[model samples]
Target: MQCDICQRSPSSRLPFNCTLCARNTLYQPRIQLAQSLLQKEALEKEVDQNVAGTPKPTRIIPAPGGKPSEPNPSWIVQRAAAEQIVSEEKTQGIHDHVKTLREEIQNTKAEIAARKARLQKRRSEFASAKQELSKSQTGAVENMDKSMRRTEHRWDILHNKTAESRLFLCREAALLYGLHQRKRKKGGLGRDVYFVGGVPIADLRDLNSMDSFDYGLRQADSSIDASPAHVTTSNTNLAHLVHLVSHYLSLRLPAEITLPHRDYPLPTILSPGSSYTGREVPFPGSTPSHSSNNSPSASRHADQRSLPRPRPLHLDKKLSALAKDDQVAYASFVEGIAFLAWDIAWLCKTQGLNVGGNSWEDVCAMGKNLWQLLLAPPPRPSVSREPSSKTPPQKPSLSRPSTAAARTLQPENPKDVPPLGHFSHGTAYGYLATASGTEYMRDWGLQHPLRVIEKVKAMLLAERTGAEWEILEGNEWEEEEAGSEAKKETKKDVVRPGIEETVILVRPGGVESGINEGSGGTEREESDGKGRGASGWMKLKSR
Candidate 1:
């Protein structure tokens, strides 16, 4: 047989046997070894046949004819030798398999990390949503309390018994600041102000370099002794600004003053209103009184039933945001606030409140600063306007976006429509330009600017045309519920409208001239012949 261990050699025990196979192959590890021994024995028999000690004859073994042996122990040894030759190849293959698996594991880990980031972002969004919900609830409760207080208070009784009156900024900025007040028996304005409280305009820097990051709200002491304090006439037209200031001053006032009657505007020779209450009657006193008949006692029962929430700071309240002064950044903001103030004053037809001295550009910058101050929502109190109702739920005028220019002046509402942020005086001027080129006013060849202003004012203030609300309620989903409330609550105004003075001048009827070319020296002025700019309106002198 062929030996698997020594590939080229033949086994000694094969077919029958050979003499050489008998001597040397017997030590092998298979049946062949035993067979070789038996063959050697047969040679001994041959020797016996040979008489005496004659030489033995050679024996030959031949190959078997075709069939191969079955797998036995001898075959097993052959297989083991074949397996050993292939062992290194098999080992290398196993190493490659392990390497492939490690790469796969790394890829899986990377995928898991990406998914984890997505989960974290989703969690943050959910948290913010929850916070907004809590705020809305608290706001609702506070509004309800304020509504109760205003509704139950017997305002008329307080009006008959008492009278009242109320600035920005850092004390040093008073010259550039405005003054606001609320007064009694004023038929015209609810809010009005002189210059916002400030120091000399020159002393104030154009840019607010000192960081307001460290500023904080300190609660005014709620408990104080009743005593005489500084009191002034207040106007309803400017009441919002006044309310904000009065409340702010309440925190630091050296003397406690009594509130007065309905807030009246600072007086003017010609107060523009249905009936004129001209100029404020300054109360001569070393100290102003703190007692304005409190919201009448009759009204207290209903008002006392609930915990009153604090009132929100109004337009005049000092809001400070620190941003760049350029028009692209913060100028628009200042303009919006100024516009709100000026518009309100005009609507009430109050006098002496026009924005002057400082350019509209500067006012817009101020507004931008205020936006930062509004980071957290200011407190808002709901005042009821229902006709003497003693009830569970009373309706109140929504203060947000109440004035015509309010929406125009405010920064964007998080949930409101885009492009609805505040506007500056310059923006207003652009909006009103060239509305009607053909219409002109003439009085027997003599035209007056007063007549022209009235015409333009009426046109600009006229209700919006062709705008309508659309409702989309279908299967499509959105981030928030589509709201009609936004449309209904929208208010339009410029700055604190009533506190700042405003004017509109149109040359007769449709014939109009702009403030830019009002000077007679201009060639265009001679051609238009629309007469001089606002000659005798209440705001004319202020301008």
Candidate 2:
């Protein structure tokens, strides 16, 4: 059964609390992490010890001062000092007899020197002739050229290794993402949906829109969803955001926003890969393989002798999926990507979380950022509301557009509002239309560790103020305390026929029925302050 607060299946085994509840209730996840880290460290050590030809140090004994001396001296020391001295004196007499032999050798050496001087004169002439024959240019320049080539070769090898390792990491991250996607379809470990500030959101929706988000739901072809799913269009939701943040702040998406460079920047478009280096040895029986086959595809690319050749720009394999977009979109994607990377860096260092490999770190980290993105408030509305924007609030109850300042949450003129306001008409009710279409928020189970619904709900419900108190309640009976609660139940009937009925996943504080049942709309058209009695959007004070 789902926990009332987090609405997740808690782990029931002895000594094991529910992982969902554990996350909500506990501040640290140390024990499980410590065990995993210890295991990895052991594996690394085992690998290190198995490598071949590692050297071992030598052992030695010490001497008093001089190093080890002659073995005969050691024996002599063992004998009595007088006996050793007498033996040495007898040897000296033999040495005097050898002195006569030395004199005779000196006389022979003098004769030999005279003959050698004549031989040396002949050798000198031949040596000079040989030097003339081999007058090669063996100068400092040649030595410098050789050293430089070696350095360049080493640089190339290092570069290729670094690039390949990075590519492997990116590929791994993509694979991990794919696994999470499949698990979500099978409903294995449900980390897809999570709540933040009490609002439920799906990570897949952030990555992909709603129509494409549903998977495990009933389908006609398979068992997922027997009938075609009815989904609200994304435009209306965009309208609701305009009502909530932009309309108030009057901000809009800027003409442009400055973006930072990539998490790992690529090289110049014109330059070839770093200078080539060390060759790869052939595998086992392939000893005949080329000596320099080690470099990656990018560096090994040949036939580019022409000037300013175009280079193939490949991203790290893990990051390659992101490399497909056009410049502007690529730039936009990176902003979110960089933010995710920063978050991972923080978690790995501060939380002591075991991130495992580069791929795991990248995907999970991206999921983390995607999870928080829901809390990122919309930009204020534009200087002038776009034609597509909610019609100037007048006649708002109907679908008709008006040129006047439509009655909205603000102090709208009677002229601003039509006699028949768009209570459920126009795009004004888009948020309600949106809330009804929460399937878009379900994809989080596939991409994150926390189920999407729980995370979003927490963000929306955790610190409910007087305004949000009713929406966060666990049951329908208790939700009536909110002033707007009455209208919420009434509004459930307002949904167009064939759309799914109200089903809110209460979290953090408790389970909730329909959000509308307890949390009624502000009477936006008539509201004086930020509160619009029936139409204004609710906002997080915590943000």
lDDT of 2 by residue, 444-485 (tens): 122332232233324323323323321232344345335344
Q: How would you encode candidate 1's per-residue C-alpha lDDT over 1-543 as one tens digit per residue?
A: 544444334543344344544434655556666666766675555444343333245452322333422223443455556566567678878888888888888888888887788888888887898788789878988898888777646553332222111012211121122321111123422111121221001001211211111110000122221111101111222233322332432221111121234342221111123112222332322122223335566445333332211111111321222121232223222222233333332211111111111222222222222221221112222122222222212121112323433333333333221111111122231121233211211111212123322332332223111111112223321322233233223312211324332222222222222232232121112212222221211121112
Off by over 4 Å in 1: 1-237, 240-543
TM value for model 1: 0.16
What's the TM-score of every candidate structure?
Answer: 0.16, 0.19
Model 2 TM-score (2 dp): 0.19
Best by lDDT: 2
